[model samples]
Target: MSGEAAPALGVLRRREFRLLFSAQAVSVLGDRMVAVALAFAVLEIGGSVADVGLVLAAGTFPLVATVLVGGVVADRVSRRAVMVAADLVRVASQGAMAALLIAGVAEVWMLALLAAVAGAATGFFGPASTGLLPEVVLAEQLQPANALRASAVSAGEILGPILAGVLVAAAGAGWAIAVDAVTFAVSAACLLALRVTPRAREQQSAFAVDLRAGWDAFRSRRWVWTFVAYFSLVNLLWGAWGTLGPIVAEQDLGGAAAWGAILTAMGVGALAGSLLAARVRPSRPLLLAAFTDSLFALPLAFLAATSSVPLIACGAFLAGAGMALTISIWESTLQRHIPGESLSRVSSYDWFGSLAFYPLGLAIWGPIAAAIGVGTSLWLSFGMAAAMTLALLSVPDIRRLPVAPPVAGEATP
Candidate 1:
C-alpha cells in the first residue's frame, strides 16, 4: 500500500485495539452516568452543597495521592492486569454505593468512603491506560489511536448523561449507579480477554529509585512540565465547574435534565472534534492545542454571566471541542516523545501535576460559592482558565512544539 494511502482505519483491524476501544467505550459511559448519579445522590441524602464538594474531594484527594505510586507499579507489572484489578475495585465500590442508596441507608460518610475507593482505582487506571495504547497500535497511528479513544469517550459522554437523567428520573440515582457498576464489570471482562505482547522487563529497582527516575524523566522535558503546570490551574477550574455546575442547573436553570442536556451538547461537540483531529495534522500541534484550551473559559463565563441555557450550551459545545482536540494531540505527543519504558511513570507525574489542585478546588468551591454566589465563583474560574492558557502560550517550547515527521515506511494519516 502507498504510504499516505494506507488505511487510516486499519488500526481497528487489530484485536487488542478493538478490545481496548470497546472496554473504554463501555467504561466511560458508566463514568459519565456516575458523574450525574453521584452528584444527585449526595443531594438526595439531605447533604448540603458543601457536603457534595467534600465527598468529591474525599475521592479525588486519594486518587491524587496514590497516582504516582500507581504509575510506578504499572510500569513494573502487567499493565493489563493492573487495569483489570482497577476495574474490579471500581465495580465493587459502585456496587456498594448502589446498594446503600437502594436500601435507603446511605450516609454521607459512607458515600465518601466508597467514592475514595473508586478514585484510588482510577489513579492506577489512568497511567496504565496512557501506557497501554502504544502497546496496541502502530507508532504511526498514535494520533488516530488517541483520537479514536477520545471518540469513544465522547460517545459515552453524549449517551451516558441522557441515560442517567432518564434512569434517575424514572427509577432513582441508585439504579443509575447500578448501571455504572455493570459497566465496570464489562470493562474488566474485556481487559481479561486482551492478549498483549509482553515487553522486556526492566531490572527490579527500589520503589524510591524507580520513582526518582520517573520524576527525572518528567522534569527533563520543558514542554511536558510547562503544560502540566498550566493544566494544574485549568483542572482546578474544571473541578469547580463540575462541583457547582449541577447546583446551578438545579437552582437557576431547569434541573438534572437541563444539566444533562448541557453535558450532552458538550459530548456532541467533542465527538466532532475527535473526528476532525483524526484527519487534520497540524504543523504546530501544541500551539494549536494551547490556543484551543483558552476556549474552555467561555462556558464558565457564559454560565456566570447569564442563565440562558442556549448560550451556556453553545459555550459548552465549544469548550468540549477544545478539550477533545487538546487531549488527542497531547496523548499522541507524549506517546511519541517519551520512551516506552518510562512512559507510564512520566504519565503519572503528568497526572499528578495536572490533578494536584483538583481536590482542593472541589473541596473549596462550594464554600467559595456560598460566600460569594455561584455566579461569581464561576466567573473567577473562567478568569483563571483564561489566564493559565495565556501563560502557557508564553512558553516557547509549548508554543513552537512541532509534530515529529513520519518515520521511514510509516504511514501518514
Candidate 2:
C-alpha cells in the first residue's frame, strides 16, 4: 500500500506472469490446507499418531526421491506441460482420497498411498515451476514476481490450516480434502491458459548425462552450494525449536490455541515482509537475505526465555518475516544467475540439499530435548545456529555476490 511498493505491482500487468502467479497462489492454498486435512483424516479412520507420521513421511520420501528426475524432465520438455500434468495428477490423487473418505471406507494405507502420488506430482511441479516463471516475465520482474508469489504462499500458510480446520469441524475431513482437490483443478485450468515458449536447449543427451549436467551446474556455483550447506545445518538445528516449543506451549502457556496464534502471527509477519521485498531491492541481496534469515534465533530465544505468549509470538513474527525476505531474494537470485536450460535441475539440487537433513532434524530433536530439558535444548540450538550463521557470513563468495543486471529485452538468457 505504500507509494514505493505500488511500482512492484507493475509485474502483474504482464499477462503470462499474472496467470502463473494466480495458479501458484491457488495451488499453494490447497497444498497447505491438505497438510491439516490429511492428519485429521488419519485420526478419523482410527489411526494412531505413528500412522499420521507414517502417512506424512510417505508423502515426503517420494518427493525427495523423485525430485531430481522431475527436474530433468522439466528441462527436457515443456515446463507448462509438466506443470499442467502435475496438477492433473494431484487432482486425481486428492479427488480419490476425498471420494474414499466421504464413502467412510478410507484407510490409513489408502491415504498414505494417495499422498505419495500427490507428492510425486509435486516433485515434478516444483522444478517445472522454477523453470517456467523466468520464461514468462522480463528478468527485471523476477523479485517482484517472486515476492507476489511468496505473498500468496504466505496467505496460504496463514489461512489454509484455519480453513481446513473449519471445514473439517463443520463437514468432516473428507470435505476439507475435497476442497484441496478443487484447488488443484483450478490451478490446472490456469496453467492450461498460459502462452509462453521455453528457451531452446539441446535435449539429445542421455538421462544420466543430463542429470550429471545438473549436478555440475549446482556444484560449480560456490555461493549456491555453500548457501545450501549452511541452511541444511540451520534447518537441522531448527528442529529443536519445533520439537520443544509445543511442549513449552502446553505446560506454560495456554495450549494449542496459543500455539496457533503464535503461528498466525508469524504468517502475518511473512505477509508484511513479502510486501517489503516487493519495494526494496538490495545490492548485496544474498548477504541481506542471510542476515534476515538468521533472525530465526529471535524466536528460539523467546521460547527459551519466556512463557509469555505475546512476547514469544512477537519473536515468531520476526522469524517469519526473515523467512519471507530470504525466500523471495533467494528465488530471484537463482532465476537470475542460473541458466534457463539448467535452472530447474539446479533448483532441484538446491531443494534436495535444503530438505535432506530436515527429517533427521525432526527425528533427533525430541530425544535431545528429553536428555537435556527443553529450555536448555532450545538455547543450545539457538546459540549453535547463531555461531554457524556468523561463520557462513565470513565466506567471501556470499559477501561479494551481486545482483544480475537486467535483461535487454523480454527473454531470459
**Ten-residue region with minimum lDDT total, candidate 1:** 1-10
| Model 1 per-residue lDDT tens digits across residues 121-162 | 999999999999999999988988888899999998899989
lDDT at residue 38 of model 2 (Cα atoms): 76
lDDT of 1 at 150: 93
Q: Write the per-residue lDDT of candidate 2 for residues 1-413, one digit (tens) a residue.
A: 56776667888998998899999889888876775677667767897544655676667667877789999999999999999999999999999999999999999999989988988888898999998988988898888889999899888767876677677667788987888889999999999999987567774899999999999999988889989998888977876665565467657876444665676677777888898789878888889988999988899989999898899989988998999999999999999999888999999888778766665565566667768888888889899889978988999888878887346673322
Off by over 4 Å in 1: 1-8, 405-413
lDDT of 1 at 39: 87
Alpha-carbon deviation at 319 in model 2, angstroms? 1.5
Task: Estimate candidate 2's alpha-carbon lDDT, on a 0 to 1 scale.
Answer: 0.83
